[model samples]
Structure formats: C-alpha cells, structure tokens
Target chain A: EPEVTQTPSHQVTQMGQEVILRCVPISNHLYFYWYRQILGQKVEFLVSFYNNEISEKSEIFDDQFSVERPDGSNFTLKIRSTKLEDSAMYFCASSDDRGWETQYFGPGTRLLVL
Target chain B: SQQGEEDPQALSIQEGENATMNCSYKTSINNLQWYRQNSGRGLVHLILIRSNEREKHSGRLRVTLDTSKKSSSLLITASRAADTASYFCATDARNFNKFYFGSGTKLNVKP
Candidate 1:
C-alpha cells in the first residue's frame, strides 16, 4: 500500500530560526493536511492543502505558518520563526477524497524548538 | 474550543481483554475515524464510520457512530499487548476536510 512519507524524522532548531518540514504524499492523492501533537495533548489541525492552495486552516495556523506544494508530490510546511511552544510531533496526511474517505498518514517529524 | 473530546484518559487491561473508548464531538460531521498511535509515534488509521453508517468493523476493531448524539465509540476486542497504544477519534466535519482529533485514550494492555 502506498503511504505518505516525511523528511527529517526529527528536527531541532533555535527558537528564532526558521524550519521547514517536508512531506511526499501518496502519489494520486489530491488532498493534503498538516497536524501537530504537543506532548500529552490532542492532535491539532494546522492546515489543509489541495490544488496547490490551502483550503482551510485553524486559528493556531498563524501568519508564521505557510504550506506549499512546491512540486507534484512534495508538500512542505514552513515556519518563519519558531517558538518553544512549537515543539511537537508533526504529521502529514493525504487522501484521494475529502470529508468521507480514509487519510493515510506519515510517520511524523518531531520538531523541537529550543 | 476543541470539536471532539475523549473520555477516560487512560485504561489498563490484561492481555486478551477488550478495550472500549468513547468520543464526543460538538458539530455535525460527515464521518468519524479512529486512529492509533504508539508512544511518540504518528497516527495510524484504524477504522472509519460514515455518518450514514451506524457501525463498521475491521479485523478486531469495531466503530459505531451516532449522529444524533454526536458521539462515537471504538471497541478493540481480544486486545493484546500490541494493542497498547493511544486511541483517538477524528472527525471530518460537514463541508470540510480538516480533521478535529480528540485528546485520545491511552490503553496499556499488560501481557
């Protein structure tokens, strides 16, 4: 089965530095999403991308966060300036259909902003 | 405000037991999905129950969705030590694809 894959399984960066998390979604999938899980907290939605644009985003997805499908398969999330509270496990998911179909998720990238 | 919240933050059971977790949401949803995550790991898709479907099963996992009540339940039967993980319920709300996940239930199946 084809699965979503992410780059840099773990990332460590300074609080003021920028970070980019990359993901290669399932080839045929049209919808992509990014979620983050803080330690001992629920998974929180960050943003969703489809057709080369963000479809929906959460309040947590502030101006510091941006997502782009730079290429056919590569979807990246860029944080302009990281914060200590941004430390979390970031997961990328994709699905061929929306709102009703199953979404396959990547193993996730653990981001630590110190 | 979170859209979904899970009950019983933690559970412990002997091997070969059953684990049940409940999820309650605030908004109408198109579907409810169950996912599992091991310690410090990513979410893994387990089962999905559509709004129109009351119940669905895959292998040892069973999920039921009650639209009227805006709640769902996931049952893992004959669970083993491998089933020891955090289980979460994610909702695909009406008219959108983003997932709202609950806090999850941590199950420790003692072998």
Candidate 2:
C-alpha cells in the first residue's frame, strides 16, 4: 500500500537554528497535515494544507512555523528558530479528498534541539 | 474530560484474551478514529466510525461510538502478542480539518 514518507528520520540542531522537515505524501492525496508529539505528551495539531494553501492551524503554529508544498508531492515544515521545548516527534500525514477524515501518517521525524 | 480523552492509561492481558479501550470527548465530532503505535514507531490507522454510525468492525477489531454520550470504545477479540501497542482515539470535529487525539491507552499482551 502507498504510504506517506518523511525525510531525515532524525535531526539534531542547535538552539536558535533553523530546521526543515520534509514529507512526500501519497501521490493522489489532496490534503496534508503536520502534527507533533512531545515526549510523553498527546499529539498536537500544527497545521493543515490543501490546494497549496494553509487551511487551518492551531495556536501552537505560531509565526516561527511555516509549511510549504513547493512541489506536487513534497510538503515541508520549517521552523525559523528552534527552542529547547521544540524537541519532539514531528509527524506528516495525508488523506485523499474522498476519505478526508482518515489520515495516513508517516514514520515521523524526531527533532532534537539542544 | 478533554476532546478525545481515553480511559485506563494502561492495560495488560494474556494472549487469546480480549482487550477493550474506552475514549471520551467533550465536543460534537464529525467522526472518531482509532490509531495504533508500537514503541517509537509511526501511528497506524486502525478504524474510523462516523458520527451517524454506532458500530463498525474490521476483522478482529470492533469500534462503537455513542455521540449522545460522547464516548467510544475499541474492542480487540482474541488478541495476539503483536497486538501490544499504544491505542489512541482521535476526533474530527465538525468544520475542522485537524484531529484532536487522546492521550492513548498502552496495551501489553503477554504471550
């Protein structure tokens, strides 16, 4: 079965540095999303993208965070400046338009900021 | 008490037994979904039940949703050791594209 895939399975960055997490969603999917889970915490929604634009975002998705669909299959999340609290597992997910409610998640990129 | 909050943070059962996990939400939802994650792995989609539907089943998994009570349950019958994982319930609220996920229930099936 086709699945969402993410690059840089693990990343280590210095505080105040920038990081870009990349994902390649399923080819035919129309909607994409990003979520994060702090160690031992619940998964928190970051943002959702559709039609190459942000559809919705949570409060945690502040100015420091940005998402782009630069190409047909690539969805990228960029953090301008990382904070220690930003250390967590970032997940990329996608869903086709027909079953938009059911999301397929990638293996996730573990971001560690020191 | 929050949206998509599951009960019994952890559970353990012997192989061939059944496992039932419960989840509750605070808001009206468009649909409820269940996901499984093994240690340090990705979230795996298990099943989804719509707001209008009461029950759904896939193989050994059964999901039931009660919109009136704002609760849902997942039942795994005759589970195996591989069934051990963290199970979470997520809610897709009406008019929202994001999902609100529960804290998750950790299941340990002893073989």
Candidate 3:
C-alpha cells in the first residue's frame, strides 16, 4: 500500500528561526492537509491544499504559516518565524479526488523549538 | 466551536479483551472517521462511518454512528498488545473541508 512520506523525522530549531517541514503525499492524491499535535493534546488541523492553493485553514495557521506544492509530489509547510508554542508533531495527509475520501498520513515530523 | 470529544481518556485491558471507545460531537456531520496513533507517531486511519449509515465493521474493528445523537462508538474485539494505541475520532461536518479530531482514548492492552 502506498503511503505518505515526510522528511526530517525530527527537527530542533531555535525560536524565531524559520522551519520547513516537507511531505510527499500519496502520488495519486489530490487533497493534501497539515495537522499538528501538541504533546498530549488533540491533533489540530492547520491547513488544506488543493490545486496549488489553500482550501481551508485554522486559526493556528496564522501569518507565520504557509504551504507550498513546489513540485508534483512535494507538499511543504513553512513557518516564517517559529515560536515555542509551535513545537509539536506535524503530520501530512492526503486523499484521492473522491469526496470525503480516507486520508493517508505520513509518519510525521516532530518539531522542537527552543 | 464544533469538536469531536472522546470519553474515558484512558483504558487498560488484557489481551483477548474487547475495547470500546465513544465519541460525541456537537453538530451534524457528513462523516465520522476513526484513527489510531502510536506514541509519538503519525495517525493511522481505522474506519469511516457516513452519516447515512448506522454501523460498519472491518476485521476486529466495529464502528457505529448515530447522527441523531451526534455520537459514535468504536469497538475492537479480541484486542492484542499491538492494539495499544491512542484512538481518535474525527468529524467532517457538511460544507467543511477540514476534520476536527478528538482528544483520543489511550488504550493499553497488556499481554
């Protein structure tokens, strides 16, 4: 079974620095999403990307956050300036074109900002 | 805000025991999905139940959705030590493209 893949399984960055989390979603998937889990908290949605544009975003996806599909398979989330609160497990997910399709997720990148 | 909240944040059982987790949401939903996450790992899709359906099963996993009550339950029968993971319930509301995940229930199936 094809699965989503992410790079840099774990990252440690200084506060105020920029960070880019990369993901390669399932090849044939059209909808891509980013979510974060803060330690013991629930997984929170960050943004959804489709057709090279953002389809939806949450309040946590503020000015500091941006997503790009720089290539056919690569979907990346960039944080302009990281904050301590931004430290979390960032996950990338993708689904086929079918509406409400099951989303396949990557192993996730653990971002640690200090 | 619309959110999926799971009950009994933690559970522990021996191998071959059944585990049940429940989730409740505040509003109408288009579909409900269950996911499992190992410690510090990514989420794995378990099952999805549409609003029009009442119950669905896959292997040892059984899910039931009651849209009228805005609640759902997931039952894992004859669970094994490998089944020890945090289970989450996610809701997809109508016209909403994003999914809201619950806090999750941490299950510890001892061997």
Candidate 4:
C-alpha cells in the first residue's frame, strides 16, 4: 500500500538555527497536515494545507512555523529558530478530498534542538 | 480546546485475552479513528468509525461509538503478545481537516 514518507528521520540543530522537515504525501492525496508530539504528551495539530495554501492552523502554529507545498509531491515545514521546547516528533499526514476521509501518517521526523 | 480523552491510561493482559480501551470527546465530531503505536515509532491506523455509525469491525478489532454519550470504545479480541502497544483515539471534529489525538492507552500483553 502507498504510504506517506518523510525525509531526515532524525535531525539535530542548534538553538536559533533553521530547519526544514520534508514530506512526500501520497501522490493522489489532496489535503496535507502537520502535527507534533512532545515527549510523554498527546499529539498536537499544527497546520493543514490544501490547494497549495494553508487551510487552517492551531494556536501553537505561531509566527515561527510555515508550511509549503513547493511541488506537486513535497510538503515542507520550516521553523525559523529552534528552541529547546521545540524538541519533539513531527508527523505529516495526508488524505484524499473525500469528506471524513482517513489520513495516512508518515513515520515522523524527530527534531532535537540544543 | 477540544480534546479526545482516553481512560485507563495503561492496561495489561495475558495472551489470548481481550483488551478494551475507552475514549471520550467534548465536541461534535465527524468521525473517530483508532491508531496503534509501538515504542518509538509512527502511529498505525487501526480503524475508523463515522459519527452516524454505532459500530464497526475489522478482523479482530471492534469499535463502537455512542455519540449521545460522546464516548467510544475499541476492543481487541483474543489479543496476542504482539498486540502490546499504545492505542490512541483521534477525533475528526466538525473541522474534518484537523485531528485531535488523545494521550493514548498503553497495553502490555504478556505471552
């Protein structure tokens, strides 16, 4: 079965540095989303993208975060300046346009900022 | 904030025994889904039940939704040692695009 795939399974970055997490969603998926889970915490929604634009975002998705679908298959999340609290597992998910569709999640990228 | 809350954060059972987990939500939802995660790995989708549906089953997994009570339960029948993992319930509320995941229930099946 086709699955969502993410690059850079793990990343280590210095505080105040920038990092980009990339994902290649299923080829036919139309809606994409980003979510993060801090250690021992529940998953938190970050943002959703559709039609190459941000459809919605949560309060946690502040000024430092941005998402881009620079190409037909790539969805990228960029953090301008990493913080110690930013260390977590970031997951990418995608689904087709059908309402109430099930989203397929990628393995996730573990970001460690020091 | 709308959040999915799961009860009995952890459970353990012997092989061939059954495992059940419960989930509750505070807001209206379009659908509810169950996911499984092994240690230090990505979540694996298990099953999804729509708001209008009361029950759904896939293989040994059974999911029941009680919208009136705003609760759902996932039952894994005749679980195996390999069934040991964390199970989470996620809700796709009125905003179908965003999903809120619960803290999850950790299940340890002893062989």
Q: Which candidate number has the best lDDT?
A: 2
DockQ of predicted candidate 2: 0.76
lDDT of 1 at B71: 92
Q: Is candidate 2 or candidate 4 better by TM-score?
A: 4
Q: Report clash pairs, candidate 4.
A: none
lDDT of candidate 4 over B4-25, digit per residue (tens): 8997899999999999999999
Write model 3 residue lDDT over B1-111, tens digit each, in one string: 867899779999999999999999998888899999999999999998889999999999999999889999999999999999999999977644689999999999999
Off by over 4 Å in 1: A98-100
Q: Candidate 2 — number of clashing residue pairs?
A: 0
| Residue-wise C-alpha lDDT for candidate 3, range A12-42, written one tens digit per residue | 9999999999999999989999999999998
| Model 4: fraction of the reference interface contacts it also forms | 0.70
Instruction: Categorize the docking of model 2.
Output: medium
Q: Candidate 2 at residue A4, lDDT?
A: 98
* lDDT of candidate 2 over A29-113, digit per residue (tens): 9999999999999999999999889999998999999999998779999999999999999999999896457999999999999
Assess each model's interface with DockQ, reporting 2 decimals per model: 0.77, 0.76, 0.77, 0.79
lDDT of 2 by residue, B25-69 (tens): 988889999999998889999999999999999999999999999
TM-scores of the models, in the order given: 0.96, 0.98, 0.98, 0.98
Total clashes for model 3: 0
Model with the higher DockQ, candidate 2 or 4: 4
Name the 10 consecutive residues with the lowest summed lDDT in model 4 chain A.
Answer: A95-104
Which of 1 and 4 is the better model by lDDT? Answer: 4
Which has the better DockQ: candidate 2, or candidate 3? 3
